[model samples]
Target: MNPIATKYIKLNTAIPGPRAQELLTRKEASVPRGPFTTAPTFVVKADGALLTDIDGNTFIDFAGAIGTMNAGHCPPQVVEALKQQVDQYIHTCFHVMMYEPYVQLAEKLNEITPGNHAKKTFFLNSGAEAVENAIKIARKYTGRKAVISFERGYHGRTLLAMSLTSKIKPYKYQFGPFAPEVYKMSYPYYYRTPEGMGPEQMDEYILQRFQDFFLGDVAPDDVAAVILEPVQGEGGFVVPSKRFVQGVKQICEQHGILLIADEVQTGFGRTGKMFAMEHFDVVPDLVVMSKSIAAGLPISAVTGRAEIMDSPNPGEIGGTYGGSPLGCVAALEVIKMMEEQNLPARGQQIGERTMQAFARFQHRFPQVGDIRGLGAMCALEIVKDKESKEPDKELTAQIVHACNRRGLVILSAGLYSNVIRILAPLVITDEQLEEGLAVLEGVLEELCL
Candidate 1:
């Protein structure tokens, strides 16, 4: 039998204990295998940073729904707002009849997101939809068809977004032909830089390639935009230097191309800032946001310069369920909660504590190859050895599964699938944070040592 009592974790049975096993059987019978799951069991309830499974086992949530719960699960304010909205109305599509909440959210986003310049905001239902629309607006405004995205940056699974994405296997394999005129560029990976290349040199090298790329591959004037994830999320929590980000912005400016910051995974205090682009002091012409925008509600937004956003005619860009009433109300409440609670500052504190723990793990384990992140969006890359630095994809998978079995919910990512990333909620208590990290450390000792 598994342990019955712990401070936060309570395991009354084995991981997929009886109840969860029954659900898993039913799930396998009905659901396709295409959608992957990190944790094996099914949840009965979830709160701030913990999840209680159907089998009565409780686990610390380090994944935070892939960085979607920055304000935490079921935040009271957001929930209350949602309930109030449901009582009033659920869906009165913005296209058919406009609502107060939709306009209110737009005002809040325009004021808080990175710039003081005149901006306009519009809503969609998912990150991919926002990216797709951002591209449409950019192309319509600039009259150019080419788009560039960084290597290992993930936008979403939609055709155009997927074509812009760099991962080839599970995300794009055999699902072609891909959209045309999408290009890939190098993003600075300091830890994995070629032997003897200093960090500054690596940044300069990649920036220089942009010039060469324009000359040899596509003319800059023909490019609509360059979309980037301020800090690469699905490509592992790879954080680029401020210099690198600003350099990319400068190139976009010189070339008359729009800069699109895909903040789907890094926005709403996931990275110790309201928006990750603020960290680099680069104001993107177009910003794509989702994930934590409404505390896991299926809503996305594209905020851009007024002139650029205005290029699209009224009927050309909206969907039937574009901005649901519930989503807008929840998002407005979420933004209010974030400001009142100062969640971004709290995220920075969590990040510092986690990074310190990772540093200690590196001292004790040879397999802990590299640790990198921005704010609370932290990740550790696992390798075969420090010297060789060969990605240990198998070991990474084992560690992740083992952690899950032991009442800690963690996930792995990276181009090589060898990175263990933590996306715990910004509202997670210090005690919950420490307990989760302790479980991770214990697993590392058992697996790596």
Candidate 2:
């Protein structure tokens, strides 16, 4: 068995070791190739910021199940809550039976999510569902048809959500005849800002294009909502300035278009703040949330202004498992954990440290083209060269694969798939975080140097 010297990551064998290989064979037969997996090995256990494969290899989990474990895997309180909840009941179907946890979680989200305005929240099964429902509510409230989403923004995989998403390959390619009336707009990618334009100028240009779009493409009055990620997720963790975000909000207000904050990956303390929207000081009419909401539970929420949220008739929204009791209970505990432990501040610390390392990487490795993040949601944009600034998709994949093989779980993002993203758990110890970063650094040194 091959092993690496490390504190938390214990590489007992090659990534897909004997045991994992057997399971992989089975998985290949049973599971479709459509659903992608970052790590080749199957995880037997996970906790805090670490995961153990079936082969007994332990890995520091930087991916955090694609930002679904900000509170960390099997957080004690959340696990305990789920256990107690299971002991009481598992699925009563909130649609059929009224449950307190559902109402309790909704109340908690409304209170914690940005904006002091009277807000209401409803639960859903996934981020895509939340996006779909949020759009429905926006359209119902405004009686408008068209909706606008930004370039490189990722909403979800469902029809409407996929239509709203910007990425083409893997997500939208061959999945067409996408949802109609959904439009795309340019979101500022400052790193790749046009040849001569400055960041603020770029922002103004994109904002102005909205007016041009209204005249050339669709009327602003017909737009029900303009959805955006406060910090783009699959779009490479790209963060827009407060001016850019507020500009979008101003336009929405001017045209009577609802602003929907798709915080699926940026919410739940992942972005340092409780929600990324707080960074921009823009309160959205509708907020789409999932991922870290329930500490890995398959639960999502649409929290927004009470008036906008209540636009749909009573039975117009909701599903069989929309607000499962276990999800509600786990979410309640997750929020309590975030609050009592001050995870958002911890997330900020993670981002600071991560960006610091990334900055050093930029100086040391020419391929480390750009580094940007908000809170713990950090990323390194890989490029062929600093001058060319051409995306190095191959190198990014190699870095990710090398890191995973060496016992650090990581992920890739961006339209070009050249952004190495870090979504480490906030509860990770400094030593663990350092060790994980060290693994990544080592991979960069090996691959880029």
Per-model CA lDDT versus the true structure: 0.92, 0.93
Q: Which window of 10 residues has the lowest lDDT sum in candidate 2?
A: 1-10
- The parts of candidate 1 lying over 4 Å away from their true place are 1-5
lDDT of 2: 0.93
Error of 1 at 30 (Å): 0.8
Worst 10 residues of 1 by lDDT: 1-10
For candidate 2, give the lDDT of residue 172: 93
Tell me each candidate's TM-score.
Answer: 0.98, 0.99
lDDT of 2 by residue, 36-83 (tens): 998999888999999999999999999998999999998988888898
Residue lDDT tens for model 1, 290-330 = 99999888899999999999998878897888778888888
- Per-candidate count of clashing residue pairs (backbone under 3 Å): 0, 0
lDDT of 1 at 361: 93
Model 2: residues with Cα > 4 Å off, grouped in runs: 1-4
